[model samples]
Target chain A: MTVENLNNINNNNAFKVPENYFDNFSQEIETRIFEENIKKQFGNKNPFKVPENYFKDFKSDISAKPKSNFAKIIRITKPWLSAAAGIIIIFTLWQFLLTGIENKNNQTGNNDSLKSKNNIVIANYQPEINTVDIKYLEPEINAYIDETDADQIYEDVNEDNNETKINSDDETVYQYFIDYADDNDYTELLAEL
Target chain B: MNAAASENKISEHISNKNFSEAFNLIVNQYKERLYWHIRKIVIIHEDADDVLQNTFIKVWRYLENFNQNSKIYTWLFRIATNEAITFINNKKKKEEESLGTYEHRLSDTLESDEYFDGDNAQLILQKAILKLPEKQRIVFNMKYFDEIKYGEMSKILETSTGALKASYHHAVKKIEKFVKQY
Candidate 1:
């Protein structure tokens, strides 16, 4: 080739690319750099596989199984069970108190009825003698008798009996009378009338 | 490791299957310059990308047997140049047959290489280089464009220094005639 012609290659400017061809190039090199990095990283990582303690945190969960169901019941239901026990105790105590009160009330009713009967029986018969000695009668009967003056009590009772004085003694003797009174009113006594 | 012996230690580490260390060394030493060099040769961003991958693959595969006889960059350049040449040859083979004469052959290569997105005169110059023989084309690229010394070029090409200088000179003369004509 001619040396004068060689001016063309030195004027080698002929084969130049666009102005910014190399300046503002694409990220291909960066991509290759990354690809190389990944290759390098994976190449190193491939040969290593350690026996790591993967399940360290799972120990508590495993241990808690089956036994934890029992424990959980205790944990979750402790307050509820305590509340139930408290309610049962309260109900039992309430029932017991109610039954005791009912029994006492029933006894009071029975004593009232017995006292009414005693009053009726005493009404029909007057005392045999005046100033009857209290020492002679049973203490229990005396207590049951309400410890009032017997003469005024029995007189008030029999005078209201409406007995027909058949004989002189009949007025003072035990009279046979029928009672048809709701409140044990001794005044309700009747002979034939 | 400490900087006390990072160079020798890093080189030793590269030989011990320590690819990460080798990669770090490659990045620090050759990354920017190699990228630009490749970018200039292949032109299109994507084609350069493909060539760069093939280049590194070759480098990694042949790293152990690397004689450590030359500059690491020259070793790398040989691989890059080989990959680029193979790619262009394959590309040329795939397309239609090139024109018979040297001048027409150069025109066909530049016209065919979609990556030759250069301005018109630059395109014409590249076309002229493509018309030369394969050895002349490589010598022309190393000397004219890359400004690489013929000594290093001789080492990478495994050619005698005298033959490289002659090839470069002949390539320059052809390119000069072509550029002036264009």
Candidate 2:
């Protein structure tokens, strides 16, 4: 087939259509218009509505306010920056928590070993103290004394006619230190301090 | 219809405040032509119906503002053309497709449309027309199908006669090539 042969081709189209389509189309449009008039008489209320003053301010909305390039860059990057800041905060806190837990575990393990070695037999009990080691252990010993159960120790001392006054409920005056602190939250708190 | 006589009648009826009478006259005079024009642009009977109705509604609203210097049919054709183009643009935008894709979709619609009356050769011609760029398609349609003059097309499309002639010539060559291959 060539462009020259185009004039020889049939002009009639092969598309099919329903019967009386054009005749019915005019009637359909008329019906649509009648329905529209009826709807208008009922009040031309738009079934769909937009925000108040939307159409009124639509033109102004079209012309977006000019933004500085710096502001545009900030707008683009703001969400990512906030997300990174949140991640950094979480990571820093996680590292701090892990360090605290590790220090507490080491301290508790050392105290448990020392206590096992220092236990008295009571059958033929004798205590030995090394003066040089005492200097090395001074801070631990003072911390232990400050954390002692004053009520139980004082009760024992008073019943046995010793001279010490202590109140268990006064947290500032009496601190109870449990060896190993049950290896739970108390040890973490002591390590944090 | 005598363009001058109809314009005078329309103007007289409007000036006399006989709006419905004037509108009826306008519809009777232009409806079929406008329907066919819109039909070619939209390629579906239902869409043409909607656009025709909208064109009239717009004419009704803005008829008083009609510039008396131009022919009434030209003015009506211009409105019909804009309404049809707007309808297509809005439809395409809603579907999120480009104009080329939208035209292909219209060709598909032509095949399935219950009211389409064209045969295979006519369908092939329409498909070829759809493949042309939108401006050339319009130029080709007006020139080849409707036998509309370039001068009148210039007014309706707001394009120069020389450009429209060139567009129509290119469109003819492309369509001929397509038809030959088909």
B64-178, model 2: which lDDT tens digit per residue? 5677678788899999999888787777766789659999887887787666656666677678778998788877767766878888999999998767766866676676667
Q: Candidate 2, which segments miss by more than 4 Å at Cα?
A: A1-193, B1-4
DockQ result, candidate 1: 0.00
Candidate 1: tens digits of C-alpha lDDT, residues A1-193:
9998888778766577655546434443443343343334222121111124412221211112223232333354323222222222223334445544232213323322111222212222322211011111223223423454434434434455555322223222223212222233321111000
* Candidate 2: residue B71 Cα off by (Å): 0.9
Superposed model 1: Cα runs more than 4 Å off = A1-193, B1-10, B15-17, B39-43, B99-118
Residue pairs in candidate 2 whose N, alpha carbon or C atoms collide under 3 angstroms: A13-B118, A13-B119, A14-B118, A14-B119, A14-B120, A15-B118, A15-B119
Docking class of 2: incorrect
| Per-prediction TM-score to the true structure, in the order listed | 0.41, 0.47
iRMS of candidate 1, Å:
42.8
Candidate 1 has an fnat equal to 0.00
